[model samples]
Target chain A: MHEQDTEGVKIGLEVHCQLTSLATKLFCSSPSDYRGKPPNTNICPVCIGTPGSLPVLNRKAVTHAAMIALALNFKIPERMLFFRKNYFYPDMAKNFQITQYDRAGGVPFATDGHITLDSGKRIRIGRMQLEEDPAKLSYDGTIESSTQTFVDYNRAGITLVEIVTDPDFESPREAREFLNKLSSILEHLSVSDLNLEGSVRCDANISMAGGRRVEVKNISSFKEVERALNFEITRQRSLTSKGIKVMQETRHWDEIRRITISLRLKEEEQDYRYFPEADLVPVTLTKQFVQDVKKGMPEMPEERAKRFQKDYHLSGETAQILVREKALADFFEEAAKHSKDARQLGSWLAVDLQAYLNEYGKSLEELKLTPKHFAEMANMVSSGEVSRGAAKTAFVEMLKTGRMPRSISEEKGLKVISDTGFVESLIDKIFSENPQAVQDALKDPKAVNFLLGQIMRATKGRVDPAVANRLVRERLAAAKGSK
Target chain B: MTKKQRQEQFISEKEVEHLAELAKLELSKKEFTKLRGELNEILGYFRLIDEVDTENVSPTYHVQDIVNVLRDDTPTPQQPDMLLEDAPQKKDRFIKAPKMI
Candidate 1:
């Protein structure tokens, strides 16, 4: 569909994408990838703003920020500036967040107007900026003194792409669809990884009747965003209906409770003290750079969707499910390369594999088995060596022991019996024993069909139905004339 | 264009205060009054956008650039213990604290 066809509702979104740089802090060269490491160990005198550790900007981080702005059709400043956004928080060892204020560290996002979507629907652009992320909060065990909070700077000081949208969304669902589209674009760009720890965070400002918009904070998931906005809208609407006003404040999404609770009052626009950064020079996207980035951009979601349909012959639903996570899509393609039937590959990944993952609340990437192993299983089922039902059992075994599909099938002896001679012998005994079926077989084709049903039932679902039917017909025809 | 449009486009100070309360923010009356005009102006701007023939416009939630950037199946570290060292309380490798005291 053309991007122009999608303008039915007033919706807007603010997207924050994290850049997982190898460097810890944007200004302080601590360490960026903080997985499974001691927290304070990852910190440094500079990151904590110790008196003499002067801050130096990570040039790579600045470039990443600029790249995102350019992709969004924002005007990049020739010079970049950094600002100390004053806020009190324990997560910030410095007690204040150093971020790119108004025009993000000289790479301020000066989005003049609208961004056109693949749907051809144009949503007005607000501003995009770069900022250093704050350390994440580690909640203690108990709410009331049961636990204490901790800070992990692993996420702190990493560069972030903050894109604000004009208030263009009218409903919760639109906001959801828009977020999905954004995640796809960021995935295609390789700039942000949503599945990472605390990588993408969302805040929604919802209002109606020109009433005050209460900004919902720290909604990390798209599902949570949908729920929070819906609840907040109802909360706001009821308040307004009952002569209550919608205050401009911040609220938290209690994901556990599925409710938005008040956190703090809304800050004034001046409260953020958004000023241009002074230290860095503004960056200008040369016509050359924009072209280069555009060239580097992989086929977008829509294009990839079409390609999956064309290349893999996947149903629209199957392709969409695989593409939801780039890793899953890669897994499907990699495994399909080894498989004989692409449809079986798709079904295994989209339906059967996902069913198991859901039971465990995991994803395919989290499994231990490789794509080669997965395809082997798919191949076995498609070749009719094992029933699709039996293939699931073999798959579990593969996951458990990393065994080959053939060996797992042998160990369980779940192979189907398709020999026509063996089945024809069984059919002869059955026809002589059931005199009633023989008499009816000569009387009516429909009654003869009932005897075939009995033969299949006798095999315990091990025999192939088509082979059994063919034998039953030949055996029954000869017996009728001989009698 | 009509009374509905004018009424729909305006934001009131009282409503701002209510929204602030829902957000759990303690706003000064002064800020509440000023936000009304600013809110309306912003609303007015949105109204201008609402008028644009967006019948074909697609809303972009994310600026497309990044695709799934994932780590290898290697397990990343969880939060470190030192972070919790300064916690108000601790109990057997977990955070412990007083009851709302």
Candidate 2:
């Protein structure tokens, strides 16, 4: 039987990204760097929702949110309003969460934005709103088996911008691409560091062929988002093929089990009873304010990639690889300023340097290698100061020791043997040592490469193979003429 | 109709039960009936506002005539030990709660 087609799959994502760039919590003066701190240590009267405490919004968070909205092509409202979404959960010390609502005299931070994937598929954003994150709850053991649970209020009031997208994705891969593009855009804005754990979270709603939509929550990473969607699509397909109707419900992605488990359905539909938050006055975003934010915005990944292609004469693929990470692109641009061959430098950084980073299990920041080192290395290879192979060897040494390329090359004797007299003497010595090989070279042209290999082994790749090959051919022709 | 007759039509016992459930309140049978009557009286009082002819008036979101009430993103020193002193149940530095499952 033919496999089920995934063309009818529809996936929409509600992504929550923390505004980690800010120093304090959204509504309180508590520090926002709660990751490594002890539990319940980062709480305050306002964040923990003490009875008499009133919430004061953070000004920088609004600026960061506006920058993000502009980057994603969202429409900023003239005035932004906050609402109280009432719900009962242990994660929230306050019964109601302060969030932005789109209806009932509430205007969200932004709306009607779209991100275009590399495949030219545009994922329309429904709305973007600012809200406070809930406290983190951890069980002593598994949730079902734990005797007690603990709550850490440190994360309770971190500012988060939740972006809800229209159900425009047709497949799991498309959804993954959209997430990657969004993450790159977020990184360029520098509003949130995606590398931090729990910095970005996504809840996906997926359906098959107009079936009942199932909402999957707790997807923690981009890869897990694709995995959960693939698993859900398969589960729904199996149910539909058996003539069973898929139920509309919420599920949790079990990261360890690699499956989506059904969460207990509430007896009644959740009535959030949203109302205007009287504690926080509405924020009026003026045109000048937005333009000021736009002025401070950094060049995004897409624009950077295009600039790389135009200025550096780099291949589209190479430019994309370099620009995927903001730091890597910055490194490339810095090195290109001093390098003789920017195109070669771009390729080396994009391909070889990335491989070294992966092999050593290190990020670019952890490496001692600087842009000056990269520029020097690229210039050496282009100027025939060192063979590409010898430069690669020196490159590894530089990665390990953080030394300059010139010093590493000098210490390792990796510089190309450009002296004609020195190379001729080495070849003559090789001809005397391997007389049998010399005879073979005179008889068969292919044997000349064997003599060149011997010279390379002696010099430890210090001699350029091209120069050695030319010298070997000239000496062999002279010997043949003499015979 | 008398005010008492009109107030009785405002809130029902079933609605009171639903509200009690939402608020996590455990109301006895007598309490439910008494609370329902009290809630109806409160609603009847609010109904008097409907008599005003204010069609063009905008809804008031906040009583204070202010906008952009915000602070800089700077952290102040916090006393976690002092803050955790008010918790009824504590485990180490965390606030311990009942098993969710």
Report each candidate's C-alpha RMSD, comma-separated, in the order given.
11.9, 5.8
Across A1-483, the per-residue lDDT of candidate 2 in tens digits comes to: 123468789989999999899999999999999999989889999888789999999999999999999999999999888999988777888889999999997899999999998777799998999999999999987888899989999999999999999999998888888887888888889888998999999999999895899999999987689889989999999999899999999999999999999999988667788999989998999999999999999999999989999999999989988877887888999999999899889878998888998877788889857899899989999888998878889988888888998998898888899788889999989999999999998999998888988888888888977788888899999999999
Model 1 regions more than 4 Å off: A1-12, A34-56, A66-107, A110-126, A136-156, A165-193, A207-212, A221-248, A256-258, A266-270, A295-304, A387-393, A396-403, A421-483, B1-101
Which 10 consecutive positions of candidate 1 chain A have the poorest summed lDDT?
A1-10
Q: Give the per-residue Cα lDDT of candidate 2 at A372.
A: 94
Determine which window of 10 residues in candidate 2 chain A has minimal summed lDDT: A1-10
- Name the TM-score of candidate 1: 0.63
- Cα deviation of A294 in candidate 1 (Å)? 3.8
Each candidate's chain A: what TM-score?
0.72, 0.80
TM-score of each: 0.63, 0.82
TM-score of 2: 0.82
Backbone clash pairs for candidate 2 read none
